[model samples]
Target: MTLERITLAGGCFWCLEAVYEHVRGVHRVESGYSNGAHPSPNYEQVCSGTTGHAEVVRLDFDPAVVSLRELLEVFFTIHDPTTLNRQGADVGTQYRSAIYWHTEAQRALAAEVIREANEHHGGRVVTELQPETNYHPAEAYHQHYYARHPDQGYCAFVVASKVDKFLASFKRLVK
Candidate 1:
């Protein structure tokens, strides 16, 4: 099977990771830092907003199961791409909205989706579309955070809401 991947930063990686884990075509979603100047930057460094890294989820998926456009639709729908460097109260460059495309086809599709989403959101989409590098997976404790801590405050309030939105809107895409 031909697998395609994209990196997305929409607020906290935990939120995106939680929602993506439940999607039908997503094979893997790893939380990482990208588009940063520093190499091997840790969570604290990224959170400081000085590393230039965005907390991102790199997803591996099969196009036969779900098209890139469908994934982009979900990405744009679930998060407030209109916000710059913040989602809800989570503020910082690490929380920026960004799409890191892996291929030209992906890049083109992402731009198209962003334009459409911007139109729908009244032309205020602040989501950045860029070629990302310097990816470093978050510490193991961060992996599957929502699943492991469903009752936790952040997960219950923020992440679960996003997941509910995804599940409600994209019923056919749920696995």
Candidate 2:
């Protein structure tokens, strides 16, 4: 089966990574920084909001099992896309809602998803649909953070909440 890749930034990479890790048809999920000016930015630089980088997850999935549209649907369900440059208490450009589309078709689909989301909901969709660009992997400690540190304070409180929401909302998609 051919695999497709899409990178998204909805909030903390840890939150996104935790949710997607349980999603069926998601071959892999890697936490990283994307659309940044810096060539190889560390977590600190990205967090500083000076690198122009957003904390993103690069997903590898089999389209036959999980359509891009369905993936985006789950994405919207798990995060508050209406909030600009932030998710929950994480406030910064790195936590902004964004979709980095890898193809023209993906770009159109991303826009359609945003449109549908807005139409279905009462508020505006703050998620940005942008072309995919360079992606730099975050520090080693950040990858699979929630899984590795389930008992950690932030993982137990913040990341776990999002994971529960994802599992509850997308039961059919869960592995």
Candidate 3:
């Protein structure tokens, strides 16, 4: 099986991690900070907005099972790509929408997908497309956060909504 890796920053990492973990093609969904200025920024540092990092999820998936286009469609549905540096109550550069590609093909596809997403979003899709860089895995507590702390306030209210959206919108892709 061929595997492709893509990193995405759309609001909170927990929300992305929570949803992608349930996607069929996804082998692993790692919550992290990406394209940041800091070499090894922690959650607090990234949250402070001084680290120049966006909370992101690095996904390992097989394209044969779930194409990039499908994954991106799910992403657009889960978060408000039109918002700049914010999702719900979360604010700062760390919560911005972005797509960090690992390959040239992925880069090109990301551009096309963003354009389509923009049109559907009233021409205001603010998702950034960039090369993956300066990535640092978040602390252990952040991994599988929704599954581990489903009752936590943020997970119950915010993350759960995104997961529910994914389930409702992409039933066939759900794992």
Candidate 4:
């Protein structure tokens, strides 16, 4: 069972984290900041968009159970790849859609996914595919936020919609 890791940012890490947690082969999802200037940036600093970082969820998964292509499909479905530097109400560089690929293979797969998505939607895919960079885990409170606070306003209104979409669209892929 070989495990691989990929870092992605589509909006608030909480939303992405919540969706991936239910993915069949996902081992773990850690909310973090990546491609930033700071060695170890705090959430506040990264939120300011000065760190050049995006709020990403570092996903550890089994390739046999869930291929990178499948993962990217879920990712593209849950987030708006056409939007630049924003996801819904969250607007900033930190919320930009991006894929921080860990290897050449992942890079190629990400590019293929983006190309396919763009072709399917008939619009430009704004999602950035870049090499993996330094990742700073967000504050402990931010981890599993939706699970721990499902009734919270943001989770209820925003994250829940994505979760529902994931569950509905990927019923066969769910564990």
Candidate 5:
């Protein structure tokens, strides 16, 4: 099956990475840095909140199993799209919400979803939709982080809750 790519940044990459891993159509999810000027920026540079990079996850998925709109729906629910440059206690541009669309169609779908999401939340959705640039895969250690470190406090407390919520609400989309 052919796959399409979508990149997103919402809060910590760990959280996004964890949720998408269980998504049905998603074939691969790689944590990365995107929409930044810094080439090959490391996690420290990104966490410093100066690189203009958002911790993003690039996913390869088959639209047949999961529509792009469905993915965005899951994305909005998993994170507070109304929040600007932060999620929970994580505050910084690195944690900003964004959707890096790979095609014109993806961009349009993202816009439609964002508009509907804003109305649903009764708050402006700050999630940005833009073409992707300057993407660099995160350090290998960051890959499948939640799966590898489920017992870690942040994963257990923050990431797991989002994952559980998505699984419960979007059961049909889970693999």
Candidate 6:
């Protein structure tokens, strides 16, 4: 099976990681920092926003099982791409919406998805499209935060809704 990788940032990595972990085609979901100036940034550094890194999740998935277009659709459904540098109460450059594509085809598809999202949202989508760069796995504590701490206030209140949205909107893609 040929697997493809894509990295995405849309608000706190916990939210994205929580939802993608259950996606059918996804083999791995790693929370990380990417497309930043720092060579190796820790969670604190990334959260500070000075590192220019966005909190991202790198997903390894089988294209044959689930197409990238489906994944992008789930992404747009779970987060508000129209907002710049924030998702809900989270605010900062690190929380911005972005797609870090690993291949030319991925780039093209992401662009097309963003265009459709923009039109659907009245040309207000702010999701960034950039080549994958400088990805560093987040601290071990963050690896499966939602699964580990389902009752944690933030996870329960903020992250859970996104995961629910994904499950409700994309039942066919659920693992």
Q: Model 1: what TM-score?
A: 0.98
- Per-residue alpha-carbon lDDT of candidate 5 for residues 1-175, written as tens digits (9 for 90 to 100): 9999999999999999999999999999999999998988999999998899999999999998899989998999999999999999999999999999999999998989998998998977899888999999999999999999999999999999999999999999989
Error of 4 at 77 (Å): 0.4
Per-residue lDDT tens digits for candidate 3, residues 1-175, read 9899999999999999999999999999999999989999999999999999999999999999999999998998999999999999999999999999999999999999999999888899899999999999999999999999999999999999999999999999999
lDDT of 4 by residue, 1-175 (tens): 7899999999999999999999999999999999989999999999888999999999999998999999999999999999999999999999999999999999999999999999987877899999979888999999999999999999999999999999999997787
lDDT of 5 at 118: 88
Model 1: runs farther than 4 Å from truth?
none
Question: In model 2, where do residues sit more than 4 Å from their true spots?
Answer: none
| lDDT per model vs. reference | 0.93, 0.93, 0.95, 0.95, 0.95, 0.95
* Model 4 TM-score, 2 decimals: 0.98
Q: How good is model 2 by TM-score?
A: 0.97
Put down candidate 2 lDDT per residue, 1-175, tens digits, no spaces. 9999999999999999999999999999999999989999998889899999999999999999999999999998989989999999999999999999888999999999999998877767889889867789988899999999999999999999999998888899999
Better of 2 and 4 by lDDT: 4
For candidate 3, list the clashing residue pairs, or say none: none
TM-score of each: 0.98, 0.97, 0.99, 0.98, 0.98, 0.99
Model 5 poorest ten-residue lDDT run: 121-130
Clash count per candidate: 0, 0, 0, 0, 0, 0
Q: State in Å the error of residue 103, model 1.
A: 0.6
